[model samples]
Target: MTEASKYGITLEKLRSRAAKGDLTQREIRAYFEPDERRGEAFAPAFKLTEFVDKQGKRPSARTVTELYFGAEMGVVSGPRARLRPRSRGRGITTTASAARMKVLAEGDSWFRLPNLSWPVSYPDDLVDVLRQTYEIPGVAMWGAEIGHMVTVQKNNYLVPLRSGLYRHFMFSGGGNDVLASVQTHVKRFGAAGTNPSSAESYLKASFDGALATVIGHYRTLAGHVRSVSNPKPTLYVHGYAHARPLPGGPYIGAKLEALGFDANSSLARKIVAAMVDRFNVKLKAFAAAENAAHPTYKVVYVNLRPAFTSAADWNTDEIHPSDAGAAKAAARMGDNIAANVPVA
Candidate 1:
């Protein structure tokens, strides 16, 4: 038996990561250390919420809400969206196998946020399919306050961890984090004929750093799961599809200039769009690598950009999906989940 064996994960799992030079058994185990700082480590108390058991009994859980970006960014205070709970016969939504999955979410605002005026984001699409289509009791959700990745990490958001059973984790982020850093990249690279060195380096460094921190938290969550289940829970992540600027008046480039950047012409839009592609590429690579390294549970990447034809038609803004756009986007993701996820 290996170190991970004691936690319900296998030695082969750790070795696989070590084989790829990602992580070693000792490093993976270190992620689970209880004797550590708050933001620096993964262990934290579970939060209590309005959710109840299958029998309507509330579990004695000391639930926690990881508050970071939402608090400071005012992401939730904007405007309330029209929320309509799906019509349901009174009972817990269950999977076909009758297991309740706990889904924990965080990241940027593209995941059909609260007060966004849209009734449903694509993540909600997952709930609708599971409850109405699959007839599963709706799983409990820990909606990490909306914010950028760094904000989520700074607050130590309670990413889904290993428990007795498998839980579902969804990520609809990276857009905001990537967009925030766009100006730096745009000014540095947009001027050149092909590539901008300074901007590219900044974007590369920022993205890599952000990705590394997030995976550390991810590994920490998996490590938590490892202590409880053999085939741990799966994490679902998506790449924001390419978005183009609106045709009229204020293009994304001009907007960047307003915010103090080098985006003087249409090239800014192209530059930003290019960065979005780079972000998604790195995300896919990261997901594939983690999936290959760990057998406890895998990372599934949903490339959502291809689902849309024109970014202007689908996006309410350059960064967010419109109501009509979200409906279609949600449907595609729901279909993907139904086809790929084998909870039943």
Candidate 2:
């Protein structure tokens, strides 16, 4: 029988469990435990916690996973990581100190997707990689539509920005923001938006306008967090690579040439792809500006555009990457993330 048939951990199965409640530690632990006898593969990455710690070592996954359950589930007590949501002026905030420590992953559907088979996407690999590398017991990742994020930190979520807790913050944005607006801007800007640079500028301007409120809210949110954090925090952002003009249905990139956005020939793909690339260009600029302006703390914009370029082999859909593609991305950036993040 297949792993899905044997293990009962299919994508939708996990998603349903996650949606309804926290995954049982026993269940999650079983996922890692060697079961070759039961015809399972051994993953050192999943079970790596027992042996290693990078700089100074941190808590075992056994400890952190205890706290990742549903709100007030109270599966464990006196844990180092905060598990319950408490009173805060605005978005959700976990109690300070006296709680198990954890690293956090935050962003959109791309970050939170729970696919089991044909698993790809950096988030897919990084989830397990994190358990091994950081030695943290748990992580909290959140994501929604761009408008949702801009509206209220993706719906009133300030996250576990506790003082001296949380090791790293990684997320994806601006993709959803630019996706729907692509046709409109291309139509308005006409052929000028076709060039990568021009496409970048147009997309950037649109986000700057559409996302100003979101940006301001994050500033305020970060300010609140910075005040609590001793060294502030470092954040990672990425730009998306371009997708082909194939149909992802009418909602996205289907029939762009017919729509008069693409310039015919490969230029069509290049122009649209360049528009996505613009987000990265803008991300770099945004990070640099923020770092320059701030006396301390930093924001890092990771560039994945080059890696994914002409990488037809790695993509499953026009936009979402295939498993191999996601793995390639995870490999490329894993060390960088490991090196930069604070160890628990």
Candidate 3:
């Protein structure tokens, strides 16, 4: 017979002897050790440690019960009630699925999950979708004591749970000074000569300058992560664009309408597309450099949808999301991380 088959018989005999107190825990541990490795190994000593440890050991009754009947003894005793069958739930939420797929596609599994610190304004539909689909666990960082401690100078103050652990990082500002400040980094290149559209050209030039500034900000953040001991992968989730025009300004779509353009104009689409594309390019460069420096650590970019609909959704006049909005965002973010990253 094979060694496994022979070992099965030995295990059966050991259990039989153990049931009658003929075999001590030490002996039980010793039998599992290889013949040449037995006695000298420390498993036997540790087995006895379990009996005296304050943490308490798995019940010895379990072993005795199994030895006598070859079945677990802790089966539920009460009458089992029939659970109502669930309807075929809606397919996983689009945002949740997309976020998960993005992480997996980037091929990084290590994640630093953070908790939401603020309330969001949207209906809880998205929150429910995230919870049901991802089965994410809440981490201790979500508590108010820890979540609000960080001061984000120009950015929204979301809880930074993984700051100590993450090597790669991304940050998203919710349509306020944070996004505006980041945008100021892009390099501005004006049109060659003045024309009727020279004013428009100058605006374009300014935006380019802002883009460069944002890139520098990202580089600085990445360096911070690398400075940590044994830094792991990190990615900052970022907002696409402001949902509103500016301080004391109309809503994004409304602004377009006021300018005699269709609220759903192609120009708006183009602007968003350009913003996304520029962000992706910068992200690729960041990822490439980080991967080269630390082959084991991977960098990634995560994009979140703009959630602003009114002034009430923001925490202050400047741009941070309300607590309710933050919670919804957190749930979406947690679900994404759980689906792609290993826990436990």
Best by lDDT: 2
lDDT of 2 by residue, 115-171 (tens): 221111232433333332332323222224444554455323334555356556665
lDDT (tens digit, per residue) of candidate 1 on 1-344? 65334444333343343334343223333322222222211112222222111133332222111221121112211121111322322333223224433344444444433321122222233333333333222122223322333243532333324333335555565454555555434444434454333334334455657655544554554444334444455666676665655433132544466544555344555556667777677777777877678766667777777666764434534555555455556566556555556765
**TM-score versus the correct structure, for each prediction:** 0.53, 0.58, 0.37
Q: Please tell me which model should have the higher lDDT, number 1 or number 2.
A: 2
Q: Candidate 2 regions off by >4 Å?
A: 1-101, 116-132, 135-143, 150-159, 188-208, 211-225, 248-251, 255-258, 261-265, 341-344
Clashes of each: 15, 7, 26
Ranking by lDDT: 2, 1, 3
Ranking by TM-score: 2, 1, 3
In Å, residue 187's CA in model 3 sits off its true spot by: 16
Candidate 1 off by > 4 Å: 1-104, 115-166, 188-190, 194-231, 246-255, 258-266
The ten-residue window of minimal lDDT in model 1 covers 72-81
For all predictions, the C-alpha RMSD in Å is 16.4, 13.6, 21.4
Model 2, C-alpha of 287: deviation from truth (Å): 1.0
Better of 1 and 3 by TM-score: 1
